[model samples]
Target: MKRTIPLAIVLTMGITMMVQFFVPHPVSVGYYDLTTRWIRIVGAFALVLGTGSFIMFHSDKVRRRRQGWYYSIISLVALVVTTVIGLGWGIRPGSILQNVIYANFLVPLNASMFAILAFYMASAAYRAFRARTKEAALLLIAAFIVMLGMVPIGASIWGKLPELAEWVLSVPNMAAKRAIIFGVALGGIATSLKVILGIERGWLGGGKQ
Candidate 1:
């Protein structure tokens, strides 16, 4: 009964949401709005549940004095401090949470993370641009044209290089992008159907159907 009730709810909600896309009736719109509000309420409860799980998991690690337990302690401290600041001070524009914590701490941390990611991206690009095969050679040439076209030096070397790059981007790149999007859309539809029909039981615990 436990699994059956949840599965039924999921099936009903999934089919209703999908059908609502094709439905233009006032009733359908009302239902959509009602469900969305309920979703937000559920989301608040989920957030609380998630926080509890996080604290418990980290606390266990810290209690065991496991490897890198200091990191877990730091995480727990950060969570508590951030939560208290946000709740107590209010996250208004001039509040300490916004001005000090967000602007001074979070913003710089995010920027640093992104800066590190840029190096990884450059490394990946270098490996991808290596021309060993015919496909790789073509990709390298296209990438070269695109990169050079964005610069003034390319126009000085060849005036038509920018136009050629634009063609490669608009025509071949866009076509491939659309094809990939279509494939993704189809895959999502298939997955949704599997879940709705109870064919996908992975979401159920213990790998049981």
Candidate 2:
């Protein structure tokens, strides 16, 4: 009964949304506006659910004194502080709480994470660019040229290297990127259709129905 009710709702909403896309009538537009409002309300409820789950999960880790429990404590404290500030002060720019938590705490933390990620990317790039084969050698040369082309030293050595890099980026790189994006879009459409058709039931917390 529980599964059936949710599936019915999903099917109805999915079909309705699809039909509205083809219909340009005022009623269809009204449905679009109404659904957006419902989306916000549903999203608010989801945030409350997610926050509760996060707090409970971290609190349980802290209670059990698990490895890295100290980090869990920090997570909970940060969550509480951020939530309280957002609710109390409305998170307006230049607010004291926003400045302290977002500017002082989050900005530096995010920067440090990305800074570490840059090192990992460099290591991975070094591994990939190792000239083990013809393809790898070509990749290494292209990457080196591109890197050199971005700086003043390349201009001193070969002023045309930058133009070659620009051509490579605009042509081959963009072509590959567009192909990847097209494949990803097709995959997304497939998944969306499967969900709308109820072929994918994973989101309802179980395997396919």
Candidate 3:
């Protein structure tokens, strides 16, 4: 009964939303806006669920004294401290502690993480861009042109390199990006249809056998 009710709700909402997209009536627009608000309410509830799950997992690890439990403690402390600060004092820029913590600690930490990510990406790129295959060679060439086109040195070497690179990006790259987006949209529509029609019941839980 529980599963059936949720499935029916999903099917009805999904079909209505799809229909509203095609119908330009004021009534349809109102319904679409209503659905969007409902979505935000559901998202708030989901965030609470997610935070609870995160805390529970980390707490369990800390209690069990698992490997690297110190890190779990640090994570929990950070989460709690941040949440308290945001809630207690509205995160207005002029708020002293909030602004200080965010600007000095969080911003630097985020930037450092991104810097570390760049090194990892560089390592991965080295492996992936190696000209071991024809496809890899083409990728390497495209990457080289793109990187060179962004800088002044390439123009010094060949005045046309930048123009050629811009054309490559606008022409082939743009077309390929559009093709991928269309493919993804079609795949999403297919998957959503399957779910609404009850063919994708894996979301219901283990009793689906």
Candidate 4:
């Protein structure tokens, strides 16, 4: 009975949403709007649940004197500070304090995090590009060709290198990426339909235990 009720709710909401997209009739539109607003309220509750879980997990680690307690403390402080500042003084983009916090802290932190990816990429490339097989050798050659194409000096020496890079990037690379993206899109649509149909009931704790 519990499973049946939730399944009915999901099917009703989901089908109404899809039909609203295509039909746009008054009844369908009203039903869609009502369901969307209810979903937003549920979403707010979900956010509270997420934040409460974050606090509980970190607080538990702090209480246990975990290896990275200091980092957790830093995170908690940052969260509290941001919440208080935004709530107390508002978070308008042009506000002096908001601009200062973003320019001084957020921008540099984001840049540094992105820069760390360079080291990981270097380590992975070292492991990946060993000339152990014909395929690996071919990939190494392509990588060097692409790297050379990016630099003015190498491009000047080999006039066709830049053209080769352009072809690689525009043709095969884009085709492969598009194929993978289309597959992912189809998979996502299938999963979403399953969820709406209540076949994917693990999301609701296997239909209320």
Query: What lDDT does model 1 reach?
Result: 0.91
TM-score of each: 0.89, 0.86, 0.90, 0.81
- Per-residue lDDT over 27-119 for candidate 4, one digit per residue giving the tens place of the 0 to 100 score: 877887897898889988988888899899888889999999989988888888877777788878776446877788889999999999999
Which residue pairs show collisions in model 1? none
Q: Residue-wise lDDT of candidate 2 within 1-209, one digit each (tens)?
A: 77888888888899899999999999999999999899999888888788889989999999999999999998998878787888888867888677887789889999998889988888988676578899978887878878888788888899898898888889998998999999999999999888888899887995555
lDDT of 3: 0.89
Scored by CA lDDT, what does every candidate get? Answer: 0.91, 0.87, 0.89, 0.84
RMSD of candidate 3 to true structure, Å: 2.1
**Tens-digit lDDT string for candidate 1 (1-209):** 87999889889999999899999999999999999999999988978778889999999999999999999999999998998999999977899899999999999998998889888889988676578899988888988999998788889989998898899999999999999999999999999999998889788878454
The lowest-lDDT stretch of 10 consecutive residues in candidate 3 is: 91-100
Model 2's alpha-carbon lDDT is 0.87
Ranking by lDDT: 1, 3, 2, 4
| Pick by lDDT: 1 or 4, better one | 1
The model with the greatest TM-score is 3
Sorted by TM-score, highest first, which candidate order results? Answer: 3, 1, 2, 4
Better-scoring candidate (TM-score), 1 or 4? 1
